[model samples]
Target: MNSSMFNKSNATSSIGENIYHYLRKGIIELKLKPGDSLSAKNIAEQLEVSRSPVRDSIIKLGKEGLVDIVAQSGTTVSKIDLDRVAEEQFIRFSLEEKVMMLFIEKSSSREISKLEELMEMQKANLEKKEYNTFLNYDDEFHSVFFETANKQMSWELIVSMSGHYRRLRLITLWDLEIAEDVMKQHYDLLKFIKEKNIDMARKTVQEHTMRIFAQKDFMVKKYPTFFKEKNDEIDLFNNFKR
Candidate 1:
């Protein structure tokens, strides 16, 4: 962990929350990669805080499956579990589809204009090859649906459950073609929203939300260590003649 990444001057809030956010960002950004060891004492020294807060932050991350604490082996960043990623993706798709339905029914001209502005920003970011910034715009664009539908808390919950998925997205964002395709999908969704075409909007949203699954084989091949592979037991009786 880089000490410079931690802002020590934010003296108004809990030290544990500050450390948690710092470490969480590092993990999500792939700076502190899977299986990387984390030392509470070292982190405390770096952040100029007590080990107590660092320990607390690690515990919180452990709850989120972003950190793993072993009795004999110490603490390390957890590997991205594909099952967890799939679960979060399912939850997001389900909830966001509902939110989009509500948004299509409730959105006003002003909200549509705001989305257009965000789309412009996304295009600008893409032109600049600022993929991270583009992703922020992408998030904000979807967030408008939840916000307009009065589901900001639901959006937050989805975000909270999407750490592994976000990390995977960060990896995929390196591909310009994939990034451009995502932008195009965003535009299509926005067009459907403007036309109040509910069925088309739902279809676009479903395809957009589930597009990441198409990248699974490539992602797993490229980052074998980051992803988990399933090992299911074969049923001998099922394969045998009775």
Candidate 2:
């Protein structure tokens, strides 16, 4: 291919990636709040790309439950479903607890060293007040454990549920004291896992997931507009009390 054609192809690929990552990050961070309207044309214009790539990105986001396309109205950010989130949390907890147990059994001292390094990074991020960076390292710490255990699907499940917990984490990041407590729990968990204590690791994983789910009320009240209207189906969130 000619140099001009190669450059054009490269630019198109770059635009596609930019559009995808822009929307994905917004959804993951809850910046594109639930039920927020989305427009391919507007997104394309804003990103300086063609509508086709924008449309493709929207479709991809939909599969991830980050966006919704109404038949007649338009595309919109997805409303938070408390029940679904709970279900995902349950599944993730069950899977990851097992993975954590396996990790405790199989991990080496070198792997523990890697985890400690990640924890140190998280601590540094916390000191710097870089909440997002802390999150990245926190994820890395957990992911390394799962990867060491060869639990790819479990890791994927954890990664998937991250978006569900992202908004809550964003809220929690504001409280330095609470963040410190969380960091301490992570440290304890790491120590127990490194000691090859399966029971402690499982309990720690369960406790962590439950703690996250306990924030449901705070999220729902703080962002009432982020939920969908109740249909004929039962609304468990309706009975949720802080």
Candidate 3:
């Protein structure tokens, strides 16, 4: 809608940018599964765009850790990197706790009402088995705290850097049991916020953010190909000789 976002001078509307978003969504939504081939030529043909743009898009996705570009085997959607997921979880838990606590001090009834609306939307999504839409609201629910606290940029930083973590979240939500737990945690957070209970709010933030790890095993087992194995931890090429 703005100059920087839509201007053709910076090539923001270039075929490459379009392709990047298209591929990025597929990766995040699990429409393009991990290890699925990413044929730039094929995509270029499908979208009626030049191969150059498709290649450019692939490179951009690679930088985001959403696509893997191997030396000889060609590119694919990267598997969920659990190590990165854990790191992201830690970053989110620490940062959001501070943000939510800040919100409790400064947020008004209006902001609280906004959060309540999002919760209702999430509930409707859950009832309809719209897991993807639920996750979108889940993101907005957390973002409200950051935005209220004047930390919108901080939330953007987390989201822009959380490709691996985001995909796993969608996969985890396939089990409505986990979705219910997540929803309860959101309500608990709301309760604490309304009460101006900083201590309880902080505790709920921790539980809410760290719940992903609690469900790690379930996620990995349920979607085996979706994640990299623990054995990947040993990068022996750097540690030993053949």
- Over 1-242, each residue of candidate 2 has an lDDT whose tens digit, in order, gives 12232234665556566677778778766678787899999876666667997899899878877789877899998887666565566676777777886787788889989988999999999999888789889878878868988988778876765565565566666678768877988988987886777888888877776675556566567677876555521344334221
Local error of candidate 1 at 16, Å? Answer: 1.2
Q: How many residue pairs clash in each candidate at the backbone level?
A: 0, 0, 0
* lDDT per residue as tens, model 1, 140-169: 998999999999999999888888878777
| All candidates: CA RMSD (Å) | 5.0, 4.6, 5.7
Per-residue accuracy of model 3 over 71-92 as CA lDDT, tens digit each:
8899999999887787676678
Q: 174 in model 2: Cα distance from truth in Å?
A: 3.3
Q: By TM-score, is 1 or 2 better?
A: 1
lDDT of 1: 0.83
**lDDT for every model?**
0.83, 0.74, 0.83
Worst 10 contiguous positions by lDDT, candidate 1: 233-242
TM-score of 2: 0.82
Give the TM-score comparing model 3 with the true structure, all chains together.
0.89
> What lDDT would candidate 2 get against the real structure?
0.74
Better of 2 and 3 by TM-score: 3
